[model samples]
Target: MPAHLPHGSRASAACLSPVPWVWPVPGCLSQGAISFQFARPAPPWPAMPPQAQPADAGRRVMLMSLTGLVLGCAVPLSGKRQSQSAWLRPPGAVPEEQFLARCVGCGACLSVCPTGALQPILSSSRLDALFSPQLVPRLGPCAPDCTACGGACFSGAIARFAVEHKPRLRIGVAVIDQARCLPWAEGQRCVVCVDACPPQCGAIQLRPIAPGQFRPVIEPSRCPGCGIREYRCPLPGQAAIRVVP
Candidate 1:
């Protein structure tokens, strides 16, 4: 340098200069210098033409939409199948498919049940059936004269019908387990189920099986599946009679 430069003048000049510079390596002062080239700002990179979308972009979008639609439809169908065999619906309830479609999962039916037999299905494998009303015989029996549930249902899931029609409505069928029934299993004189049968529905009848002994027999045609027999059964742990859908 012919004259001493101001402090940082070299760095400042390096920033302004267009020429390449030679800088000394800090620890290799006697060895050599490192050369750095100042590359001309690459002719301001040509504005890349906006890339065209893939030819199948629209197709891909449409396929995704269709897949979503199919999944949406499949979920309800799968739910219906899973819930088909789950619970016994209340009296006057429509067919399973129609009932599921019409039911809003409102607790109207459960609230109006006099016997507390109509309980809300709190949990189910299928989300669609949740909160819907189901007749739980163990909790209580469906009263034969009650039409409250059907009247309470604003949705047509439970059809509105007269109280007299309750006896004719086959919500489900009652089946007696011979092995568990007191008369059949233990040879005891038990007419409790027969006596508990709805007055209007003489569905359970006493049949003389042996000397001075009788067993309860269910006549499916006359049985409205009111579940009174099961509810009133004297046996402990799982009623000898059960109503099935």
Candidate 2:
């Protein structure tokens, strides 16, 4: 051709042959692999609206109901502290309502009862008295030695275990139902309640009425107020010394 090298010459770029231009000539490769190796583009963001979260009505109701259910179950488990019955209570404890609320009533306090002093109130009493513990001294009397029913009542019915230490609780003050007692009404020779007393506190003391017979009377200062288990006293009405608030 004019001034250019021949088309077959190595000098001609298109016709160059075994020149070994690259030290290690790369093999034929797919463009897809090269593309895959490149960095990816960033993802597009969603376009959701910024709405305010609504209050969960169902969840609130569930929580309220659960709270109510727990409180309902706890009421009876603590024994009838709210009950009108005098027997089922923490002896000597003040601010009774608060004490009973925290009480576990696990019967642990009932076990340390060295004396059978803390007896259970039986069916002979009212229905409200059901499953409640009363101090019954049928076999003997409230052990002069053991008065822990007060201290043991983690519920705080009374303050301490020792009756002496315990500021005299008006648990159930004895009322000598003159209408019932043998000396007062029936005029018999019965001195059971008087003799049954622990002697330290002579709740039922005898007074020489006639020469031969003595009438049993309650020394208001002495009677602890808890009723009898033997069902002996015969008040014309309910016991004169019935439990009161």
Candidate 3:
């Protein structure tokens, strides 16, 4: 396990390419289309100079302002979010900037993970998280038995997890989403999630979901956030899921 983060200082990998640059057009005219002026012979009737048209001037000013706004909105975006973790970077993983620079925004980990711990976030606050990933434990817990993300990560965020000594990671604690769970919903005899957890140092244990029936309850102290430092995840595809920052 790494160091415990302070309250405000902490919050939240994969890689991605750069966005094309967009700039304002030279003229302040509207996006498209133009109006035509009627051609006429020299004005024979009016020998005096023409009067100033404040209204037309104002309209042109308005149009120019609008043109600037449209151009501003059209500017292309820059770098995108990543899906892996910072700590996972190994000794010779590709150059951090270069690797992140070209990664496309596709979530292979989330799709293949068994426990459904991985989730796509809207933004990344720092350089490390750019294009990397976040773990949403509330949504699901990390799988304790397997380290599929390690093997499946093309970017090596989780790296190739060769089930070595138990990992000491402490990503976050689990909180059930009663909405999607079977025991919480039907209130019947079911321990699917608990039965699913690995036995040794179980991150999750069974407790009373109802008066008679029991449901898997997370044991924070024992859980290593998907066995990154332990081995207790209980999901088939993903290790029990986590919402690691």
Candidate 4:
């Protein structure tokens, strides 16, 4: 037998219900919309070992390779600035001080170079030459007839000139190394250098040394230093005839 509970009391409501009474703890009421939670259990944490860490060796290797690739490309692009003393500016280039001040490094000349002779100087040690345009004779010579680079320069650093007027432009003077020249050193009859000089320039003059042999001479006054002779020199490796700044 059970005793009767008081009216309007919690014990009275429990006693009236068909289900058995349970303590009002967290998540204890499953059928109601209201969730009256006083306490909650912590979630299980994921396992981690003390020895587990990032792979230092793999990360280091990747970093080194990326650095090497960047420097390797930069060597050709800007590392050659050490030789800038011998670097010749494009034809119609303004005076050195004025050119440096006006050049915007737009690389317009690099785009229109038909012979790919014009190259932009990137990453120079000197701020004046950085990203400026220069001529690379080993690749090819500035064609006597081509005035594309001059026209591309809108900054006035490189003054635009007519193609017919290029003959009067003097970029540099070619210097001959007698020690490496085939005609002067080996006494070989090589007229390649003289023959390659621009027509009507009279930049390269040949003097007869022996029968069927002649030594090439550069007339500083007449030579425009176009570097065509250096590019066509018969010598291997470095050209016997090179343009000087």
Candidate 5:
């Protein structure tokens, strides 16, 4: 027997001597080259260190702090006393302060609006105004003849009246913005609002301002202030003819 070679040692393939310790290394040698290679399997990956686990304490603290801040802010806002909003009330509605006390969030007026002009007041400075009915003229004009909203209100907030007897339903008055009105500012012949007014009510009329020029004048006494003119105004942003509470 040939002398034993130490581990990882190699003997030439050409060597005829009996070599009992030859390690094969693919392509390490030519057909007659002599070489040896020994490779131990990479040590198993080191066990995950304790530091590898996530430190979620900071995240939990941040979430808790954010939640606390929201609640803290909300508590003060909700606790503060608030008064009724200065928005226009539905037709036949009582005075503002009294209306707030009498009105319930029943959406009765909203359901009976013939023109769908009545909408629930969803947000206001006062929490009590959340569900109050207000006319959204932009959605639809308040019909002069429709008394459905007043008739449906049983809470006495909105007083009911007969159709023949015109209800003094002055929710708000229309104000003209001379700078935006076509005839007043641009010298254009725009009679949209004047034509839209109810003939019987004669809420608006063209008054001669100069020899040839005329400006529309609103008569508060006869004007129902129904906001039909606001819906009919041609200008953008705030209407040239706007209904104000």
Candidate 6:
């Protein structure tokens, strides 16, 4: 016969037993006795072998290659789009490809522009055009007699020339929109563009059309495309005259 023991004492004895023991209580005995012990934390999950790491390395290489491919394809397309747009380069600038190759993107030319017409090409999808100098005639017209941009260009992107040679250097051509010109559209007398044009090149001429009515005509051969006519046009929005390269 076993010695009689209180319920709490039996529970304590059962916990202390060297061999695992389960409480006889119906619900408590379902999973057998609970036991605990300390052992080396199952030696840290074995380091991923060198062979396994190649999968991760390959993934990184593939990602880098894809990125390069995307950039390569995008660059040519961006360059093509830029080429098709009207880009008004400063006077004395070389041919498109040569100028792009020679230009160092220094702002020297921009700094020396007397009329503030030369502006930096700040934003462009093509990386090469970024920071290159361009002419924004609406801000201020390039002085026909000034050779500052060519003189300031250390990169030879803009050829250095004397003031005398500037008349022959055609950076772009000015086109008049007859639909927007006041004289052409409304039959009004307007010679603002002709008056503002540099006298050295009589590019814009007022031709007598009807009784006391005159229309502006462009003489391409004499025009240097200095942008004076476009800048001085009196129309409210979008000047009647525009310069295109």
Candidate that scores best on lDDT: 6
Residue by residue across 1-245, what tens digits does model 1's lDDT show? 22223355343333333222322223332333232333433465786899997789889899999997787567777653533445788888888877877899889888888889988888765556678888889889998778898899998999999987788888789999989987889888888887888778888898886778787888999988888888998888799999998
Model 4 score (lDDT): 0.75
* Residue pairs in collision within model 5: none
- What's the best-to-worst order under TM-score? 6, 1, 4, 5, 2, 3
Model 3 agreement with the true structure over 1-245: per-residue lDDT tens digits = 22222245322201111211211222212433122122333665868888876678788899999996665334322344344444333212244454454334366666776766566654644433344545554445565555665566675444455454344544544455555455655665555556555576577766764467876567777655542321233333433333232
Q: In model 5, how large is the Cα lDDT of residue 107?
A: 91
How close is every model to the real structure, measured as TM-score?
A: 0.68, 0.48, 0.36, 0.65, 0.64, 0.69
| Candidate 4 local lDDT, 1-245, one digit each (tens) | 22233344243232333322322323324444233322333447865558867779988999999997787556545743342344689999987767866888888988998888778787655555677888878778989889998888899988899988887888888899999998889887788987898777978888987777778888888888777888888677899999888
Model 5, C-alpha of 198: deviation from truth (Å): 0.9
The C-alpha lDDT values of all candidates are 0.77, 0.49, 0.47, 0.75, 0.75, 0.78
Query: Which 10-residue window of candidate 1 scores lowest in summed lDDT?
Result: 16-25
RMSD of each: 9.2, 15.7, 28.8, 10.1, 9.3, 8.7
Q: Give candidate 5's whole-model lDDT.
A: 0.75
Q: Model 3 — TM-score against the truth?
A: 0.36
Local lDDT at 139 for model 5: 70
RMSD of 4: 10.1
Candidate 5 C-alpha lDDT tens digits along 131-161 = 8888877777888788898789888988887
In candidate 3, stretches whose alpha carbon ends up further than 4 angstroms from where it belongs are 1-40, 44-106, 127-131, 164-169, 174-197, 203-221, 227-245
User: Which parts of model 6 are misplaced by more than 4 Å?
Assistant: 1-85
